[model samples]
Target: MESALAARLAAAPEEGIAPVHFVWIVAKDRASGTPSPMGIWSGDEDLTVTVALPDGTTASRAYLGGLGLEVEGLQYVADLTDNPVTVTLSQIAPAAQALVRGLDVRLAPVEVHATTMTGGALTSAPQLQWVGIVDEGPISTPAAGGAGGIALSIRSEIMTQLGQVNPAKSSDVHQKRRAAGDRFSEYAAVIGERKMQWYKR
Candidate 1:
């Protein structure tokens, strides 16, 4: 949170402020050459709000309400669980399933923001709450008339980076990428195969 928002929140009670969740997601992948931004908010009515972009710039984005969005796993626990937030955009019928499928949201950056503890009366802009990358999107369609929607698995930036498999390995070629004369891992392969006589002796 920004310093101003933090100060205002400190004075406001948790229950007194109406926290509005604003989600900004990219609808298409950059490779498709027509990437677009999609914004939605958790509010009764639609309104434009100031949201921060991935590049640290502020933009006025129109957020649609009543679309039905539920955010899960936004908790601070003492346990060591690397849980990803599952955001379900509900009420997406089969007719709109094709539209959702066309969205290349994987690996796209997501920004979640919230208004101050108090509702819109305050002049401060919405504060950024969570930033993550879209891990995957699995869409569900009802066979008859059951409720269904698109579920987006969003992993935090830290968790996403930790989950990535590093290309560099313990080898001569990998070590050379760091430094030309670096040979620390040159014998890594042979050292594991070498046996010690400590057990026999």
Candidate 2:
């Protein structure tokens, strides 16, 4: 099933196309507590989706083009027909298809809020924790003795009571920017390592 989908995605044309993103809107049965897939949609809005790459990189950018949407073994894109520009999961790239198989793939970052710290001088600091993927299990049959693929999971958390600083203040703004730049550098290092791992495979 995944092979067929990969072929379709590889054959698709690239234009005003965007990467496909997914979310698992699990609705629990009020009576039995069973969860089920409800409504699903595709769009180019960055806020609506997020992609978690194997390298621990999370991007809202549509980097997959038309190839990211074609995933196999997922029921989310079985009968989509809203726009011609939209491609089904079975039509995304092979790597993406492999990642999406049986996984609730989302194209948005699961925000984690930082715990606040207070001092005697009434100082407040905001904290942030990036969401991490939770691997469920293998995607293949264990009896067949084949290596099964992993499933990715993500969830969002709110960080409240953040310090809202005035942007016009050069000293304050510079300090914040410097800190953010440092964090981004660290993130880039991790992402680079992940990319190396992916290529090695």
List, residue by residue over 59-155, the lDDT tens digit for candidate 1: 8988776656667777666765567887778646331243256566767778877765454553367767678888888877788968768888887
> Could you report the Cα RMSD, in angstroms, for every candidate shown?
4.8, 26.1
The TM-score of candidate 2 is 0.19
lDDT of 2 by residue, 71-187 (tens): 222222334222111123322336334334533433323222122112211111111223322223223333454533333333222212122344553343454576754433444
lDDT of each: 0.71, 0.32
Note the residue pairs that clash in candidate 1.
Answer: 17-117
* Location of the lowest summed lDDT over 10 successive residues in candidate 2: 117-126
Give the CA lDDT, 0 to 100, for residue 132 in model 1: 87
> Which ranges of candidate 1 are over 4 A from the true structure?
1-17, 29-34, 52-57, 77-80, 93-99, 116-124, 177-179, 191-201
Per-residue lDDT of 9 in model 2: 44
